[model samples]
Target: MTNSKDLAREIVEGTGTEVEKGRGPSQASQITALARERYELFMSEDGRPYGVKVDGANIALPLRGKAGLRSQLARIYTDAHDGSVPAQSALTDAMVVLEGVAQAADPRQPHVRVARGDGVLVVDLGDADGQCIVIGPDGWRREQRSPVLFRRSGAMKPLPLPLRDGDGLAKLRALLNTDEDGFRLLVAWLVAAFIPDLPHPVLTFRGEQGTGKSYSAKMVIGLVDPSGAPKRTAPRDIKSWATQAFNSWALCLDNVSIIPDWLSDALCRAVTGDGIVDRALYTDDDVVVLEFRRVLAMTTIDAGALAGDLAERLLTIELHTIPDRARREEAELDAAYSDAHAGILASLFDLLADVLRVLPDVQLTERPRMADFARVLAAVDKVKGWDTLESYKATARDAVADVLDGEPFAQAVVALVDRAGPGGIVLTASELLERVPAPDRLPKKWPKDPTRAGGQLKRLAPALRTIGIDVDDSKRGPKPKKQRLYHLTASADRRCETASPASPYDPETDSDQQEEGGRYRGDASGPPATRGDAGNARGDAALFVASPQDTGPDQHGYSRGDAGDAGDAEMHPLSVPAPRTHRTPGQDAEDAPQDARPTTPCARCSRAQWNAEGSPLCLDCRTAA
Candidate 1:
């Protein structure tokens, strides 16, 4: 009787000679019939199946035969044999055999299997042997892994600490520098990490040097995935973002000094599970094949580094560096971790359990910023009797206000509105340039030209929208140079519970104080009338008309008859005064028009001002004109 090895070798080496000689079945049939038996014998003998297995997922793909492994052995033998031709040939033959065997393996029959399905979070039920729960945010749950799962992936393996209540949790919270809002935000972030499909806001820790920004980030990240290390270099460009964030669970842009607009936009998408695409490296194909999502955190000395859209997707946490300039020793921190790591993890699991328990009847009355996170926190609050994450909502409101306030353009717009009073102001870009005072704090990149200024304001439209300001480009006239009208009003006081009672009526004052589309509607007609006598009006207060064509009371009902013209009107003035005109030396009097016609004695030599028509010019000036 032949042993199993001899039979297996005979089956592997057969060439159908026996069948052709009418002494046995066809080689293909013989191989197919004996393959399963050989696989069983092989596994029983070696105690290891010829297949691949991944940690999180439960499926295993089997090999048809061991030829691929033999090819690897052949290569090793060649290394030992000084690259001999025989060894190289053996490698080639082994590769061919492996390919044949893989093709011949039963495609429908899997050789190995695990107890659970592929997911981000896998929980052992523990009530009985092999009982488990697999959870994902995609609304899919299964007891078994899909037929195929990625063999190698950057997916994280979560390490959950055991559940218990103690001062250690409170101590860890203190160590992490998490207040009520910060703690809620941290919990939301953890939930988002487990539920990969949820949209999450990026947590930005900001403070001066010695702040525990990095420490807080690492400790929070370590609770879920201790192996995921924080990267100090933030992705400055789009390419870097795509390349660096692909396989990461949580990307920490530690000690970031500057955040470029591109990186900010990328982080916004990444925080919310949006895929960022990039071209595969070393490929001629122009296709963008790489896409992924990951949690993002950043430690910055300047909280104001990011602006506009990026600022909207952030939860800004200002960490006060430990007082007394005392830094906790690394060992002490580690020991703290060792003592409380399990309880903290248990708290997270407890949070998740609470969420799952109350998910059926959860009603969100208000969708706050980072609404998904807000909802989760609400669920936690419902179960735990917490304040329902009100602090976080307030923090979000303040973050938005800070971003608006920190931005010079936003500040300028706000200043213009404030100066306009409770009633908002509507002004074209040109008008804004002529009337609105420049913000005291200006950014280095502030646009100098009116054209560029208009573009910059338009770029800020989205950010302005978040603060209840509406920028309207629809007012564009037929001309390309016509400036868009930006309508800025007193941003609705989000913090106010009830609108302030209507102010006392003053019949003499402008009654159009009511906000229309968030703007104080002044007269709809045009620019205000010239102030302080046409000749005397100059600077921003003067009504500088184009071609002197609009030298009249503004359509908003302001007229020369009114003792206090609209120009003198407070914040809700009808219009901004035009610019003062300067005459060129030796310019003809005929060239100057209307209010702009110079009143100075030297006057234009050619044209005549209304009052200066009879006045005589010096002979030399006349001749030059």
Candidate 2:
């Protein structure tokens, strides 16, 4: 009888016949060579082939060639037998066929096909055993490993996750379906999934807590690897997993609080065709350069935490909380999974494979903005068949609107001014600093002493001016003027007061009215008179010439008799005559007959009075003096 080695060698030679005849080695030849070597080594010292166990099934096979080949053959045989090779004799035949099948089914060669239906993909494995693995977008797998011959049933397609089974799953499905464009976008994502050199782009799921964000992510995970689900990772672990290069199918990072700058930079570089290296976890002395070709999706409460560069590359979806408890409960019921769900996912993978096979080639242009959006939408249309590319285009347009709208500095300055209130409409340099929200929140780099903050504020002056706010430095003295203050112009105030229906009536109006009226009316409660007015009156009084010895024009250029001088003299009137000496009753009448020295009039009484009672004046005179 011919030995197993002789049989294996004959098979190998037959497979290699084409290569020997000037044709290159066919995939069959390579597989036979590898398999034959393994079969020869499995022979025991007694010359009998050992039993190879694959997943509990046993196979008796001859091992040959390299030791590594023999070990691989044993594993492959065991895997074929569902982890264990049953009988040695049966193992040999099974090992040969499987090797042939694996070689023939090499996915590297273009043979996949796109199938119809939602979330469905069909991968055609030509001839040898004709096996197909059904998978979902979330990576879930079916328990039944059917033979390739089973593919003849019909073209496979992905089925939407059953939403009627459970509330949580239903909510997730509904959230995904809320935007019709999302389906097309998902299809596009699936198309990009097969490209090896593409960067590990991030998908952001943003929403409030308990709004089914996590559930939605889980559903995606289930679709991608039904057999082996993706592990939930922390933000810090992203670097570690990303360093593994293209090994992972997808990465789902949930609950990201603060995104580190390094991670953001790395992610941006990764998505933009700049591959990253992993120096932190290299096993060899030379650094390990890992290509992050995996698809990255993340969840966060606030999308703003992501870097602007990274944000541009992302496909963000906002999830809203389900309000009606009954509806939510009904959705949860629909999402409940059965064994059929896994089958649906498998069909979806086959559908995706088919789409990839028939997709039109797209050449992106220099217009990165439009190209990126187009690429995303195109992928969605090809994979999911959702027919919502236009809607996604709208979403892209919205994203662009947000990006190119205005500078963050302008917004910050406006916010500061708004908070400063009208009581202090003018913001002093120090007060401006105080009014500004934390420097960390602003986009501009802050200086140690907040000097840079002032510069940033200055840069926003033009924007403020556009909105009618003024930057005033007039209050500063002549040389080396102080920092300017920001004040809302009248127009600006009016705009503010009118902008809000609930704003109080203009407070400045009252103060303005009082000022305009008081200038001419002379407010009784105004500041006291100055020394300049007092000095002017004294100078004018000396120039006044009225009946007395004229003090003539003094240093001031004035004639003592000038009428203009009289007004000044009234302000500082001349002194009156002294009282006459009084006469005793028995004394000479000459002393009393002096007629009180011709009293012109008591300054206060305006009437002549006798000075008989000694040189005392009237009560009115005394009081006036």
Model 1 lDDT on a 0 to 1 scale: 0.52
* Cα lDDT of model 2 by residue, 89-183, tens digit: 33344445544444343122111122122343333222233334443444423323222111111122233332223233233344363354554
**What local distance difference test score does each model get?**
0.52, 0.43
Clashes of 2: 94
Q: Write down the TM-score of every candidate.
A: 0.59, 0.41
Model 2: per-residue Cα lDDT at residue 595: 36
Q: What are the clashing pairs of model 1?
A: 117-145, 420-571, 424-520, 523-556, 542-578, 543-578, 544-578, 589-606, 589-607, 590-607
Which candidate number would show the highest TM-score if scored against the true structure?
Answer: 1
Please provide the root mean square deviation of candidate 1 (C-alpha atoms, Å).
Answer: 14.3
lDDT of 1 by residue, 1-625 (tens): 6566756665566432333244553333333333332332122111222322223232222232344334334344446447743334434444444445554444332211111234334543222122233544333233433433221122333344264767444756767654666665666567545545456677778777877788887877666444445545765567767756654556677887667777777787776655554544466764443345566777777666566667677767777657765678878887877778867766565566557567557779988657777777787778768764776666665667676776776676655554343334555667666654575765675776678778878877776666666666665533766646555554545212122222121223534322222222232122334232221122323443333344444544543323133443221333344544555788776786444554322222211113345644433455665
TM-score of 1: 0.59
On the 0 to 100 scale, the lDDT of residue 217 in model 2 is 68
Which ranges of candidate 2 are over 4 A from the true structure? 1-36, 39-177, 181-184, 187-201, 226-231, 235-239, 243-245, 272-287, 327-373, 376-390, 393-625
